[model samples]
Target: MVYYVAHRLFSAHDRALGARVAEHLAAEAGADAVFLPFCDTDEEDLVADVKGLRLYQLDTRRLGGLTGMIALLHGPSLDDGVCMEVGYAAALGVPVTILTTDFQTYDRAGRVPAWQFPDPLIEAVAHTVVRGSTLGPRTAAANRFAAFADRNESQIDAAVCHGVDALLHAPAPVRPAPKEQRGVYIEASPYTPDSGLLAAARSSGRPAHVSRRFTAGDPLGAAVEDWNLAAASCALVADVSGPETPPGAAILIGAAAARRQRVIAYQPRPAYTHAPGREPNWRNLMIQYASDLHATTLSDVTAGLES
Candidate 1:
């Protein structure tokens, strides 16, 4: 089974260790895994690494990947991207196992709904349910084990074990699409310095239809960009949290809505602010795409859409 590990990429601390944790789990399970941060998908100007069956197929042999997913819920408020990924994975019928940090309290009110997806909804979709980060280290009692490493290693290792276990145990998903068919389309803005928005979109666990994946520069001419946005299932227009919207982003949103594709707009938290007397124009057209006009979080927009 192939394993996809999804988590927030914006870290104020070390990420290598967490990545290693995911790698270790994949190793222990003897499974193939890909961490989004590590993949370089800009080959051939097509961004073809992730092949979807009309945009929702999470795994396909053509892409040489697995259909099973393991999502890491690091905190009480699930990362908007992570939440989207989990929902996307589930939407496509891929078996998902949630490995969360907040599982200990078993506080459904605090941890699960933070997903903004109704209770028993996320739970019903997951194959393996685990709370802790580590199941325990892949070590022997006779071997030397450091206390510090053990604490961390166990959490990550457990996550993998549970994920693999869940995947192996769940019913297999269907793969009837013809070779090279695509599903679940999206267009991402040119990446900016702050990862908060891009990370949220890419890690939403679904593949994007349009990509600026390899570089910050524009990958296509206006005609091609206009066509891609027109063809996409949805356009995820993300940008830095500010009053002024970027031109490229505005174009995607406008074109996407014009095409009647679902558009999910995310301006990072401090979602939007305007002069006291001024109307928040940021919400003007974007709100038309949102379920709740006043909603500020990414999870709100993606919650029911995926599940």
Candidate 2:
């Protein structure tokens, strides 16, 4: 069975760890068992272009066809792209196995809540979570990962193999018909402007559900509610024109794309303040790649609603 391995690829250490994990999995499974995005040559040309939309399309399309997905959720903060991939896999009913080596606790007040690890939305969707610990600096963690994998090989193997069995046995989920699905789900950071997108969606004669309204109060419950709205909606319009890319937006975008729902990533312009020597209009490649359309204006987003 072929599996898609998702992890951070920006840093040298991240790449090393990802490569090692893929190699180990292949050695245990088969040479062709794993599909690593960084190693794929299908989008080699698009990799050099900053505005390469096809690269994202090709990756997500390949992901949709995979049997299962294994995601590495390491580092001080979980990689945003990996989080998006997890959401996408979950939404598509593709069994997911999350392997985390980061031992740092994120719980406040030293008390662990039900949603103690990472974001509640992510934890809620994962089929299995395998935890491992690595000592020493972040730079050395990758080199030491093979030992951790060896120690936890049985657990990891069970999780991955179980996914295939569960997928084969589980009944396919029911999806709403095009006419039955009505609303447009609007997702945006509290710091960004969404009123325009909201207005545009409403003007198109479709019901608009704002994510902020549904994602308040209890964290776990809110995450469930937010996910429900996203799954039920006919389309998702997300505004990422804020100072930083909202983690929640990234999750929703991935989930929406997985459902084959229309997704419009709204970023009117580079709204971030960059330090000297840094690119001004930089945005997360995953967010842009997963979206059906990259909208620069309310009209552009509105056009996507009809498409």
Predicted structure 2: lDDT = 0.67
**Tens-digit lDDT track for model 1 on 27-106?**
65553455333232221132333322112222122122355666665543334334445544443456677766453432
Off by over 4 Å in 2: 42-51, 75-78, 104-118, 133-179, 190-200, 212-215, 242-244, 271-282, 297-307
* Per-residue C-alpha lDDT of model 2 across residues 1-307, encoded as one tens digit per residue: 6677888766777766667667767766676867888676343333434434555666787777766777877644557677788778778777777766656645333566445354566666766666654332233235567655554554544444444344334343333343355699888555654457889888777899877432455666777777788888899998766544565677788888777788888887755433223234346666766777888878887778876
TM-score of each: 0.43, 0.71
Q: Candidate 1 — worst ten consecutive residues by lDDT sum?
A: 53-62
Which residue pairs collide in model 2, if any?
none
lDDT of each: 0.44, 0.67
